[model samples]
Target: MAQAGFEDLVETFEFLDDWEERYRHVIELGKALPDMPEALKVPATKVEGCASQVWLHMTIEKGTLTFIGDSDAIIVRGLIAVLITLYSGLAIEEIGKVDVAGELARLGLNEHLSSQRSNGLRAMVARVVQTAAAAA
Candidate 1:
């Protein structure tokens, strides 16, 4: 399965005429996400405040941060994929300054998300940003 990048998602979203089609695309993105090892889904890496069980793992190598995440809810998983695309492989300085909520807004996802899902997404971004801040 081919993984879609952030720009790819934006283009696809723009191509879709309605929110339903965009939602299906998001689910497809979740389906294409690489599976996370069960061992990596421990409490230590779990994201708090999400309605679903979400785990985020961060690794730093040579000053670049990489993020991998999984969620029990399919939509949340798709949201995680978006977050990964935005944040992963970024330099510590870049990660520290990135406007994650703004990115979600630019994707038009923020307006479409339910309050619970939006809060969960915020939690996920917060965890990653915190990790980046500590690394920086």
Candidate 2:
């Protein structure tokens, strides 16, 4: 559920012609995000530079990486939900192997967001990548 799943998501977005529909689709996808347990949401894991209070954490076991994240804002939580779909279920090294910018373009998110939203998305990706790197 890495590369192929990512590609499928891109295809799914392309099937939508309206931005509002796309947003709804994205939010629906967000609902599929694995539940983030309350115990993992702490200050140190909290990501700054976001419009909302977001907490992100990682734990690697048997060489596979797992993410735990949450946000105080609904939209940002949905955004992080997108992040989890892209990066979770991968090994730490594999997470580092991704070209996030390219993937964003492939997913059509790069062309479809406000400048600030795009920047916030990149920040989220950076945090996920940094977490993977540390685990590696």
Candidate 3:
């Protein structure tokens, strides 16, 4: 029910009338993420569906799962930050329980992104969900 990541992203994007500013804002958010662990930098965690190279790391703390990741592309890094914000700090069941595709639809970002990118983003989230489920 809390609008932490996706909602915030939509609100912010809407507030920015210019795509240039929105892009900058996203990059800033990506820059704000905590450093990715060295161990997580391995090729195994690299996301394959991205047009750019992306690395994701997952951690389980208490009952919640958190994610940290990086992308070689700036905008993609920001996008990854957006994904991390929404997907992180959620338990596997909670994540799987939520209508993720619906959330993205509610935010109306799916149409803004290319079909390939949209599918890739979904794939990344799916991998995160699978990883979390496996851990659970």
Measured by TM-score, the strongest candidate is 1
| Comparison by TM-score, 2 against 3, better one | 2
Candidate 2 regions with alpha-carbon error over 4 angstroms: none
Residue-level lDDT of model 3, residues 6-36, one tens digit each, is 6777787778776567658877987886667
Report, for all candidates in order, the number of backbone clashes.
0, 0, 0
For model 1, the local distance difference test gives 0.83
The sequence of per-residue lDDT tens digits that candidate 2 reaches over residues 23-132 is: 88777766665667887777778787776677888777887776767776665676777777678788888987888878777666777777867767777788888877
**Cα displacement (Å) at residue 86, model 2:** 1.2
TM-score of each: 0.93, 0.84, 0.80
What's the C-alpha lDDT at position 46 in model 1?
A: 98
* Model 3 lDDT at residue 60: 82
**TM-score of candidate 2 on Cα atoms, chains taken together:** 0.84
Q: After superposition on all CA atoms, what RMSD does each candidate show versus the true structure?
A: 3.3, 2.1, 2.4
Please tell me which model should have the higher TM-score, number 1 or number 3.
1
